[model samples]
Target: MQTSSFIGAVDIMSTQTATERPILHGGRREAMREAYPAAPQPWIDLSTGINPIPYPIPTLPAECFTRLPDPEAATRLESIAAAAYHVSDAAMVAAAPGTQILIELLARLLPQQRIAILGPTYAEHQAAWARGGGSVDLIPDLDDLPAASSLVLCNPNNPDGRIIPPARLRALADHLAARGGLLVIDEAFADLADRATSMAATLPHPAIVILRSFGKTYGLAGVRLGFALADAPRAAAIRTALGPWAVSGPAIAIGTIALADPAWLAATQHRLTHAAATLDRLLTDAGMTIIGGTPLYRLAATATAPDWHDRLARAGIMTRRFDDHPSWLRFGLPADHTAWARLAAALSGNRPPLANHPDQ
Candidate 1:
């Protein structure tokens, strides 16, 4: 799927040079507002890997907010997550407001030394380590990781979906564990990709910690729920660092229900797979080279990625472009047929059909 049959055919303003724009993250509609004041209403945001069709949220009991989060409910949520992730022990799971918080906590908990992060990843790992006063390095491959006291990487990586074999990662974890070092694996997108690549199924190691994001897969980022899978001591340390009531009552209730619902998971997986394939077809039809991505999103390599991005933005269709990788652009799956047609028309530089009106 790297090269497309429609290459050099679609007129996406490919000849026009686009002005360099500041890097912006997905779901930041306000940023888009400032960038494109009169583009359109209800922007079609395809910059993030989050599922466009969010899970159906259950109505919460009033007590979810009136009272403090129950420790037992939090425990139950962790247990559900543990079972969902195939964690060997429920005690190994620690619930947090978000995995971003857990990443900071891990950076603070782990010993300060050379921390190597697999390159071109979610930028927070390096910043979080720096915030915790830990030294950092961005290594391109796993072979260059031995010298670092702690190594962090996103499995089924962000922007471009790259996955490291579980066995190879486990060997690295064992090596780091033997030296009292840490190996952090961010499995944010693993829910939609190959689940076997997750370290959750592996036996707990003193030096290994896996961060699982509940929001991305479940499409409830507003819930701010995430989990850390680690040995008891490390899990306890993260809990202690986050303090009491680290996760809200509503979050626990929602996470427990969502993670435990195997039926919903299966259905959503199928829906996302179908949606991703549709997105691939749409992008390829627009002459973009689909390099790689998980079911949640597609990454394209193109000589005129910037121009395509600009054209799309003008049409109120937002996609992610990397500052470092000028030729690369990432597109998340559109929510419905209307959004699909809207993006297709934007990329092809044609007006969206009136019948397939863009939804707000």
Candidate 2:
């Protein structure tokens, strides 16, 4: 299989003699709000696969606001995460504001190495590597990956939500290890349902690093806490790269509580499982194909994905649509049945009841 080169706005400068181009519109909340104005009831935000029902956040102690967190607070959070993931306490876990920070840190730490990335996945992984001065080879298939110094992949990949089997991923990791190459698994969404399938539980396989994020699973993206798990030395190396006090006090407090609550985890999993199945059936019944996903979200594609996205947005519903693959769309399971009905009606070309409202 031939690999396509991963290009970003920066690469555009290399080809064009022009000095500047229009600033790219980032998908920040402000921009999204402007592009899709909120309706009276608020637009349904299903663009992200974050948990619709986030772990309940408790009021923090006065110290959380009074001063910086004690160093031990981060350590305690790491310990809780390690136990939750069934990894060794000595595995060298460190928290950052989000997994994106960890990915950037890893990229900087491994600068000058040739990086191989699975494409049409998270744009940030490739962006981070490129920004850190690493040469990237974007491979479409695992077998097509070149013998590179580093590899990065998003398990249950984004946009399409296809999961690379754990056993197969391990075999690939072993292969990279044999070649003195590092394999980095971004398991940001793996906790949506399958924990046993995560490589993070048993990593530091000489050349393996795993990233886990609390944002998607616990719906704490606002708090922004995530972890990097590896063998002691590599973990220590990544920690050194991040330096001290990277995670905020509120993030540490919330992440620790969320990871430790097994009951919440179980309940969230059950909810997502049922919701995902329902979403799959609804899309299928509407003539769209539910091609892939885990329990967190469904990946569907039809000749209508682009138009459907526009139609839904006009109906006061927001969803994720991919530009690179115009036919594909990702839908996060809404917490309420009413939202699902709105989505189903939109997909079926039925005007939402609210369409007749004067406000709409």
Candidate 3:
């Protein structure tokens, strides 16, 4: 659902959907409002890959809010995260506010190293590397990767769910390591993905740094917790760069409990799977070609993508429209039945009656 007014513009929409779709903040909401001035009162924001259903946050101790974050609490969070991510040692996992920070940190650590990023993935990887002074190449083909100091990519890639196999990754890792470089895998979207393909399951490697996102998976993007998994020495380097008390007290408390709860993760995974299936049916029904995406979102292609995007926007449904890939529109799952029905009607070109306005 396009909850356009959810975030920084939560005043324009409502606080409820903003909480539901936390990733889309006030600035984007305002931009959407400007883009579609006559858009409905509230939007069903499908612009982000964040899960609408958030983790059930347990009550926090008053200290979690009042006191400075403890080093021990941070350590506990890493340990629990290691077990949750199937990592061999907690020492190899360094916790940070978010993986976005870790991405830049990793790049800056080895500045001026030429980087090869598997293309059309997350734009952030390229941006971060470039900022860190690395000459970046956007490589599209997996058959032949350029010889760069590091190979940066996502596992189940963003925009297009092109998953590179572990055997292939191992070979790449070997090649990069032999060249005295690194293989950075952003497993940000891999929490709900296949565990068998995760690089986190293997022992920590000097050449491999697996970035993990906490907020996107748990639907608690506001809590702001992520990890960088690497060899102990490398992990220590990340921690040092992070300085003291980098992870907030609330984030520590929340992440510790969330990562420790397997039952909730499993239940949420099932729910997201069902939501993705429903979304797939809805998109296909509306004559859109399913291009790619993980369970959290679907990438659809249509010759009339611009028209479709405008139509949906007018009807208060905000799907992701890429400037580069104008034919592509990424749809995050509709949060509720009203959002679902509205999306369906909009996509089908059957605007709901004014009498049915509330749900329509």
Candidate 4:
């Protein structure tokens, strides 16, 4: 079923001039502190796509702190990651401190070439490639990808959750391969998306590089771990650029255990699914049209997004607002019953929480 089906339809219209629109912000707690110093205590942040309820970290051995990240342990982590992410083999996976770092590293590793990115997605891809001296183009259609030497896209894309099929992407990869070009697929939110939406299962493609985020799915963003999966040569090049001890010892140990835990993975999926449905109802009731987003976040549209953002901010509930699209707001799932209640109250102009909505 469509994620949008849970929400009611709302007509979104805007009358304000560009300059009159208020910028709604949410991400870092420090940013929240700066923007709304007197708003409320213990801010409820929904700005980021990272999971609010993080995985329970296992107790660490003392050696994880005192010892350098062992290569063998790192290798085992890679093996587990490959299995978890559905990549063809462990040899195809390269671990990095975070996918953000890999974005920059991969951009630098590539030859300066024209790049096309699937649009209105993550801003970092454009920024990273631009810094590497590659010309960037944001194209709306998948057919346009073959025109650029390098193509970058987020599967079940960020901000707006758009997932292109694996077969069509494989065709694009083949076209790029023939031209000696590259296809960078950021599967950052694929874990909660339609499982088939991921291209990892069809990997070992010479031209395609699949990027996965451990922290986003596992809720350990601070752990500083991510993976880059590609054909042998590209994976080798990425590893060389990242160098030794690239991921922290603590990260390796945690990742080894977490990546192998299928039971927790399944339960988290179910939990996020219900939470996303609940969020959709809340946003729709507040007069927003459901846009699209992965389970990690929901994008909604309304003429008064800025006003809603302001109201929520005043109540110390920070959500994501888009600069380009003044009518859009993206919300992350609330961490707990209290957060959910707070978000519902904030959206309703700080009224008492709706009694109908039960804790997930």
Candidate 5:
């Protein structure tokens, strides 16, 4: 199931595995082409945690795209997002293009010598910290968290949905705060988690910063909306750093409407829960070991994961495959019945039905 790739740069056998797997982020259709040129068309991409069913975008005003985003309109969007997230104060939330922006800036916000990150979580946190000249330590166990100037971790983490309780996190925050340390929690997958798990509603602390990704839950990544929840001072500093019009008018308008729709939120959550259950069964039946992940995606462990990745790629069913953890494959929700059928056929090693085939 495992294969080797040689770069010949060094004779050393590095477990880094960058050559054996995709080194970049998922949903790379062009990379799929380089690997499997003869694969069939209509690729069913289940490579990201993005919701398969996106929020319905409303008709935008001409001014939204043509002119600069109004400060008042941005404020309105922040207010609505604050309400949706149960954040009491709109000032505590700083809107940006996406959570990725916040993640990159966090290292600079808190000048620290050592940054302890809980992993194998999101790769960006480590990369960002390293970029900002912080020595990064990867802590495998929660109990073994090292005393550091700053800490970064994910709540309901990516690749695998791992959550730490609010009370426990608060205690960690208190511990970090005593030593002038900062704790950055990425709650990107927290939407699918229970309401009690979110710390967004709670009073902000100077030592604690929470990041929420609107694109993942709302299925509007192109809208490029995300927020950083922190104390008044930190929020203000972030906003100042971002400057005016960091988010576009169209993003503000679309994000506001989507966040305000409680009915759509409830229905989508319900539908996603059911869909996740269906996906779990399919993966298990396909001879995979369920590892972790939320309703938006499922992480499965298999001995033949690399082979399966190649097999599915050849069938044009693109999934998120990890190089570091070679056994893991993350499957996002299929958009529709046809997508589901295609995935099932690919998993079963059967050619998809020929009707309307892209190559045919």
Candidate 6:
């Protein structure tokens, strides 16, 4: 049997290793099936903190598939995104399959620099930096930020779902700028409601680069569209680094229509707000203490997060658990009443408490 080597040193294991591991995100009905061959597919997947009710996908033009994306598609998408975010058209935006690629491109462009990343957050930032020959420092606290050449932060961080305030971020940017360092803020989840809280509009003192993902906000993860916002020169640098035709024609078409639709944006926010609150109350009533996060999802723990996750899985429900901090689990907000009921029932059942608190 042919087998592949581990992708990175992080997976170097002394013990036995598997041929392949399931990808961490939800929508893993097939993997779940492979793991438990007899089990039914999950009724609801609350693993990813994605907006449940996505912005309505409109009819695609036939030309989107027939023709290659024009170079102008990137420019038009940027213009539409600027209007939506209330930023300048000259802010310089570039789209890729997703923000993940954009991040990798950034890391590659600055390979010699030391990169500081906020901890217990997205693992890709570290992976991308390491892949590009950049050393990474995990900053658990804002004060721990090293004198690195670049910093990456995930606002309203993943898994934990805690929002780092905008003012604090701005201050950090100022500090980094004074030291001649750059800051990259991944605000993929902030669009659920806190759009105004983003520093993307300000073009602040520090060479701050903001990343926004369409997958989380517009529920277009499969579409694989994301953008970077930065000043003209910095944006030009990243653009030069990325080269041309980086974004797809379908992505450009969908993003332009979606960004221009205020009605869809407003409606999604309202639906997500209501759903997230309901999910929070349901988890809280089931005896879990809600730690953080906004209307899109909630982070909670009652000591038995792992056990609870397993129990929920057995009952055909899937939620997200953190590798770095096992005590915390994240649940994506359910879109409708049926999903909410399923999740509530899973939580209501009694389960044994965890023996040791991971956070402690």
The prediction achieving the highest TM-score against the true structure is 5
Model 6: how far is 46 from its true place, Å?
A: 0.9
Q: Compared with the true structure, what per-residue lDDT tens digits does model 4 show for residues 1-360?
A: 111211111111122222344222246666556666777878888878888999999999999999998899998999999999888789999999999899888889986489988877776677778778887777878866546897999998878898888888999899888989998999999988777999998878889999999999899998999999998788888988999999999999999999999899899999999899999999988778998988888999877666676677777887776656767888999999999999887777433233322321
Per-residue lDDT of candidate 3, residues 1-360 (tens digit): 333233222111121322243333222556777777788869888877888888889999999989998899999999999999999999999999998789779878866478888877776677777768788877888665777888988988887878989988888888888988989998989989888778987757668999999998898888888999999998999999999999999999999999999999898889999899889998898888898889888999876676677788788777776655656778888878889889888878542233422331
The alpha-carbon lDDT assigned to residue 347 of candidate 2 equals: 72
Better of 2 and 5 by TM-score: 5
TM-score of each candidate structure, all chains considered together: 0.89, 0.87, 0.89, 0.89, 0.91, 0.88
Q: Between candidates 3 and 5, name the one with more favorable lDDT.
A: 5
Candidate 4 segments whose C-alpha is farther than 4 A from its true place: 1-26, 349-360
- Residue 9, model 6: lDDT of 15
Q: What is the C-alpha lDDT of each candidate?
A: 0.80, 0.73, 0.80, 0.81, 0.81, 0.72
| Model 2 RMSD, rounded to 1 decimal | 6.8
State the lDDT of candidate 1 residue by residue for 243-279, as single tens digits.
9999998898899888989888889999999888888
Residue 154 of model 1, lDDT score? 93
Error of 4 at 74 (Å): 0.6
Any residue pairs clashing in model 3, and if so which? Answer: 1-44, 1-45, 2-43, 2-44, 2-45, 3-44, 3-45, 8-25, 8-26, 9-26
Write the residue-wise lDDT of candidate 5 on 311-334 in tens digits: 787778877766567667899999
- TM for candidate 2 is 0.87
lDDT of 6 by residue, 83-190 (tens): 777676645666667898887888877563788887767776777777788777777877887778888988877756667777888888888778777788888887
